[model samples]
Target: MKVAVVGGGPAGYVAAIRAAQLGAKVTLVEEGELGGECTNWACIPSKTLLRAVEVYKEAAEYLQDLPKFDWKAVQSRRWAVVKRLREGIEKLLSMNEVEVVKARAQPAPGRAVKADGRVIEADALILATGSVPAPLPNLPFGGKVLDTKSALLLEEPPSSVLIVGGGAAGAELATLFAKVGSKVVLVEVVDRLLPALDADIGRTVERELRAMGVEVYTSSTVLSVDDRGRAVSARLKTAKGEIDLEADYVVVAAGRRPNPGPFADLVKTDERGHVVVDGQMRASAGWVYAAGDVAGPPYFAHKAYAQAKIAAEAALGRKAYYEPLAVPAVVFSDPEVASVGMTEDEARRAGYDAKSARVPLSISGMGLISGGAGFVKLVYDGNSGRILGVHAVGRRVSEIAGEAALLVEFGATVEDLALVMHPHPTISELLVEAAELAVGKPTHIAKRGP
Candidate 1:
């Protein structure tokens, strides 16, 4: 089979490589860097910067008079990390014998794509064009008004920044700037940070951000923004009332719109412009498949990878499907937040007899020693005792996501989790602790009164 993949991003490149591995002749096309925005601008770069801050904060707790942080060195290191990863992706594509083309591409009527004035014929086409930042009205990206991508490229951290939106991107940016000595005022139209996750997770993150001196205004919207030469002035409609603020930059991390490119006309798209795909990652058009940001929400690269592999295999006459019981999400804020499967409310809404238990990280020996303040929450079927979801917020909690996902995926019961002897003096024990509490076998913490 001849496969032509559009957009050399996480979804596109992975689809191309997988298709090639399955003995298909593949050609990957991209106008920008191989790893796409996640590699060059969004995930990799932001996390690299955040990791530096994380290390510094960890060291400052014990060490005195640490060397001053060099913004230039940090920026250099971020780019170096991006470059190395981008090269690795390129090497992988080469090793798999997938042909790569650098140019703008458009889908044609047949199972073909037109790129740089050449028509590339293929048996299947995968669209993974990703997405572009959604700029707020009257606050177009320019000058002192920045999008997430432009915000990362600033020569130096602004003295002050007013960030709009409190999703994963907004929350992480607030953490980055606040830690780096920038006065950050984060405004979110939603009721809390990370509104998509469990409510308690957002509450925990908000507390941590406040401790870092970040002014958070949930249920707020930017009414207007006026960019002055040296700074930007903005008016906000907050929960309290209207408030005006000025800052060196106004970052619109509000959201992102799918960039399906020319394929939107060729395929069925959601009201939000995301390409609609089925369990097999198959679009309405039998010959076309879409993955990644262009496919829809929970816009994590790992989700894209799963969808891409399914699309590639299904396109190549395989019976692969993209059914997953749980997809974990993580926010790299201070005291990282990670959640998998249903929240308690979601479980109940779906008609499960849901009961939940939450235990503070302080209950764990490692958590106490690490001084991380957060909680592990477990949502389970009260009747059957099956674990439905696991949500956690604290230092190194991101590492617990895999175990949480597996338990939910396998329909493991609270007893199943509590019975397994987890390693001692580890943050992961918090899960076991929460499970024990749910099963009426409390350990490390006193049981609540009935």
Candidate 2:
């Protein structure tokens, strides 16, 4: 069988490699870089800068005198990391014997694609064109206004930045600039930050950002931006009243827009333009598939890998399907946040009779030693005693999300988690403690009736 995959991003590349491994001839086409936004600009570069800022922040706490950060050096290292990872993906594709074509590929009639002024036909086609930062209305990109992608390519940090949106991307960028001595004001239109996660988690992250000197304005929107050569004056409408916010630059991290490219007619799409796929990652058309950011929300590269594998296998006449019980969502902010499965409210809304318990990281020896303040929340079904979700926030909590995902996947109960012995003086122990509290047998913290 011959397979043609469009967009050599996390989804398309993985699909190409997987199909090739299944003894199918694969051809991968990408308009730009192989790793897409996740590699070239979004995830890798942003996190690289975040890590550097995190290190500096941590050191500043202990040492009275810390050396000033060199933005150029950090940018150089960011490029190096991205280049190395991109090369690794290229080598992987080469080893898998997948033919890669670099061009803007458009879907041609009848299972064929048009790229580089030629038509190539395949038995099956996979669309994984990924996404771009959604443009903010009225305030267009360029000059002093920047989107997330353009913000990443900045040669130097701006003197002052007004970030419009308080999601993961906005929060991360706010943290980055504020830590590097750039005055930052993060404005969110919603009542809180990270509206996708639990309300408490958002509140916790907001507190952490404030402690780092980031001015957060929730329930606010950027009305207009006036670029006057020297500075940009933004008119912001808040719940209270309207005010002018001046900054060296205005960054819009409003979210992302799906890019199915010229193949939009081949698949069903949601109102937000995301491609809709079935359980097996199959599109409306039988011979076509879609994955990654183009497929839908909770957009993570790891999720794309799973979808890619399923789409590839199914395309190869295999019995593979993508039906995951829980997909972890992680926000790598100062006090990192991670969650899997439903939130307490979500479980209750789903008619699960949900009960929740929270154990503050302060109670754990590791959390206290690490000098971070956050908590672990465990949501479970009261009737069935099945774990519904795990939400964590604090230092290194992102690493604990894997175990939390496993529990949610296996439908592990409070007792099941409490019975597992976690090592002493570690953040992992907080999971056990939270479970104990949920089951009405508190270990480290005082028991509260759930």
Instruction: Give the winner by TM-score.
Output: 1
How do the predictions measure up, each by TM-score? 0.98, 0.97
Q: What is the lDDT for 165 in model 1?
A: 89
Candidate 2 Cα outliers beyond 4 Å, as residue runs: none
- List candidate 1 stretches off by more than 4 Å: none
Model 1's lDDT to the true fold?
Answer: 0.93
Task: Write candidate 2's Cα lDDT for 160-252 as tens digits.
Answer: 999988999998898899989999999999999999999999999999999989989999988899998889999999888999878999999
Most lDDT-accurate candidate = 1
C-alpha root-mean-square deviation, each candidate: 1.1, 1.4
For candidate 1, lDDT tens digit of each residue in 1-450?
899999999999999999999999999999989999899999999999999988888798899999877788999999999999999999999999999999999976577899988999998999999999999777788888899999999899989999988999999999999998999999998889999999999999999999999999998889888888998888999989999989999988989999998878999999999999999899999999988999998799989998999999999999999889999999998889989999999999999999998999998889987665999999999999999999999988988999999999999999999999999889899998999999888988899888
Candidate 1 lands at a TM-score of 0.98
